[model samples]
Target: METMLITGANRGLGLEWVRQLDAAGWRVHATYRDPAKAEGLFAIAKKSHGRVVPHQLDVTDFTAIDRLSVTLKDEAIDVLNNNAGILPARKKFGQTDYDEWARIMRNNLFSYMKMAEAFVEQIARSRRKMILCMTSGLSSLSAAGSRGTASKFGDGKHVYRTTKCAVNMLAINLAGYLAERGVIALSVTPGWANTEMGRADLDPGYSPDDLVDPVKSVEGMRRIIATATIEDSGRLMRWDGSTLPF
Candidate 1:
């Protein structure tokens, strides 16, 4: 069975990935910040019959990441999904909270780099060498300016957008750095989904009815991940297998 490790697997898109992959017979290492608060994931793992295992992990915690690396040293991780992130309330240019901005950057950008750094070797040794970072279409510079149309969603959300843009760059850089090592690094956008973070209140102008289903979104992404080749690496791709602008 293929082995995959997914961060932020307690809820939302990450949880769905764990469920779908486990059902597909992949051995899943699902990590969450607090397993005690992840009853839903725990139930899914129980039903998985040992295929899904949950680990307590805060992606922003480097010490915890180091400990995890040591624990899984003997195992090869075929895919490492950097899925944990925080989306703070939108702040206008003059109203920006520097402290919150820093926190978001640590969670959304720096943690991804740390995860890749800690697990690149393990991924290299696996059968399907892939490091997938979950990004957002809101990260697109082009999309930022074209918000008058119905297709466009987020307008401001400066912190979230900037961090996701950084994530795209990180994916591209890792792809180049790990190319010779036979690893494919990709920044994947899960699209606007009906999750906690995608609620109408959080992402104004888009209701749950306007959002894609989490299950369907994750299913598409899993298909994309399964079939992605080295040539497809370093691209910012959507759940539908189409390219998104960085």
Candidate 2:
């Protein structure tokens, strides 16, 4: 069976990925910041027999990542899903919270890079050497400037958008860097999903019908990841497997 490691597997999209991937027969190493709060993931793991393994991981902590790397050194990881991210409380340009902006950058962008660095060797040893980063459509300069359909999500989420944009760039750069090693790195947009963070007050306004279901979103993204080839490396793709403007 293929082995995959997913960060932020406690709830929302991450938990859904764990459930779906485990059901699909992949040996999943699901990491959560707080395992106590991951009762849903734990229950899924209990029923997974040995296909699902939950590990404690705070993506923001590089030392913890290093420790986890040491523990899984002998294992070959087919896919490293950099899925842990945070959306800070919104603030306009003039009222920007520098601390919160830094925090968001750390969780959303830097941590993804750190995870890739920590596990690149294991991914290189696998059959499908891939690093998938969960980005956002809002991060695209073209999508953000769209006045028609994209405007429905509202504006002024500078910190979140900026961090995701940086992550997209990071994925492209990682793709080029790892190409020689046959590791494909791509950034994916999960669309506007109705997750806890998606519905948070800081999030852009969208109706219940406008938001995609977490299960549907993860399912689409999983298909994209599963079918992605070396030619698709460094591309920014939507959940439906269509390419999006960078």
- Model 2 local distance difference test score: 0.88
* Decoy 1 TM-score against native: 0.94
Q: Candidate 1 lDDT, tens digit per residue, 105-201?
A: 9999999999999987789999999999999878887775222454344445888889999999999999999999999999999988888887742
lDDT tens digits by residue: candidate 2, 78-158: 999999888777676588888888888899999999999999999999999999999987789877733355453346688
User: Model 2: which ten-residue window has the lowest total lDDT?
Assistant: 145-154
Segments in model 2 whose C-alpha atoms lie over 4 Å from true places: 145-154, 201-205
Q: What CA RMSD would you report for each candidate?
A: 2.0, 2.0
TM-score of each: 0.94, 0.94
RMSD of 2: 2.0
lDDT of each: 0.87, 0.88
